[model samples]
Target: MRLRRLFLLLLCGLRAEIQEQDVRAMVGSDVRLGCTYPEGGSFDLNDLFVYWQIPVPGKPNTNSVVTYHLPENSSAGHSDSHYRDRAWLSPDRMRQGDFSLQLRNVTPQDEQKFNCLVFRKSLELKKILEVVVTLHVAANYSMPVVSGPSQDEELTFTCKSVNGYPRPNVYWINKTDNSLLDEALQNSTVSLNARGLYDVVSVLRVRRSPSVNVGCCIENVLLHQNLTSGQPEMFAGDKRSVTDGPAHDTLEAGNKPVFSVLGVLVVAVAVAAGWLCRHRCPHRSHAELV
Candidate 1:
């Protein structure tokens, strides 16, 4: 009866060893999938083996990710062709019940369900631990760049962001009132780049106003990141000149006319001086000759 009870307890322990974990990692970064064997406190190093695999597309059997035994010394392990040197298990960590898999330079394809099984090589390789890990990878979108308040009938502007993962939400805002613009006034496009990242562009059109303050925003929901292109303020019909005040709002619109006036004054002074010298000097010379 005691032997039967111990066998049942071991079975229960094995069942309890299976754990499910979710991990999020950024693209081109290294991440560790947790597969710790907490109850495995007294195991022989020479008799231990660990295997990590991901599900194959069409096969019922899981595809190998990495395998570990001896000679790793916490550094190396045999990995599948797809994983190659980018995935490995540490022998030194395994002895301490840390059989986690380290994946390097994570890509979009690395996002998958992984299975880790640890076995003790006694009579016939007995399974001692198991873990399932789901990896979620994310990449933040680039900062938004807004261009133009070009006028044809309505003022038009374009905003773009590149190399983001999944999709992103775009927003156009009126900075003067800090209010969201009408969605019907804007058009957006999203495309996958060569690296499988998202590229987005949005064009917004608004009616011409006396003073326009507009901004663009992009949000990556997966990464919990938000980027904004600051509001640009332009005056359409303000007649204030720079000479009116130093801090007037007309600096942009008033500087060009100021430059033109200075150019005209320079040409007028040159012509006046030339005409006076030409007419007066010839008359004085002719009088001296006479």
Candidate 2:
């Protein structure tokens, strides 16, 4: 009987080793880290304690995010100042064995590994359970802004997107034809802002060509979404091609012919209206009226 009880106890302890979990959160949103006791044991709320923490970069010590103690029936003062007002645990649900932490107003800095620990105590007995969760924060990027293909011999244009997380990528696309551009034509740079969001810019330099339609695209790999500015369909170049490549000058050149055709049609419509009125209206003889 003693050996059997020891074997069951060992199995229970092994079960408490919580499996790692992955969490993805968006910037400026709230996130929840889930932790709960495994089956085979009831959680005693009278002497329960829960703690959530994250590893400090380049330091041996971990940073305290939040903590809850049921014995005191209070849970506000135990967290680090950085997460004092932002982290929360539900006392009511905790009574039912839920010890999740809800983190509010998440930012890029919140992307890290979070450790959850639960402690329970009874007369002459104590137990602890741990769970490690990896959190990834994503921020959507704005549409890439493409500016300038200077009318000089060598056209130069710049593309930029701000306030993105995990470092978004920017590249030049041939709007004239839906295809990737040559790597030589694009130069990209990424920088982080004070808030930890990424700022990206790309410069494109190519020889001046009237048939080339170009645009810039920004993509967030985490979200699997991309946005492009100055689409090729807005230009009048090649209708059959998927990508467009041209500057405003070429677009205007394409527009002049279309406008000229419209001008001629308007003049013909005015002449026809005048001719119809003259022939269809009833005319009184000038001699009889006099």
TM-score of each: 0.67, 0.71
Q: For model 1, how does the per-residue alpha-carbon lDDT over 1-290 read when each residue is reduced to its tens digit?
A: 83344233333344435789999999899999998887757556777656687877788753654555532234455656778878887666777888899889988778889888776657355677889999988887765666666746678777878887767888776656556677788999999888778888899888866566666667776666666664333434532221111111123542433334476666764564334223311111111000
lDDT of each: 0.66, 0.63
**Deviation from native of the Cα of residue 174 in model 1, angstroms:** 1.9
Model 2, residue 23: what's the lDDT? 96
Q: Which lDDT tens digits does candidate 2 get at residues 1-290?
A: 83344223323442345668899999999989887666534455667756677876888663544555545666633446667778888776676777788889998988888887665645222345778889899997665566665556676777777788888766666645455676677899999988889988788887766555776667677776666665322233222222222212124533432334476666764564334223321212111100
For candidate 1, list the clashing residue pairs, or say none: none
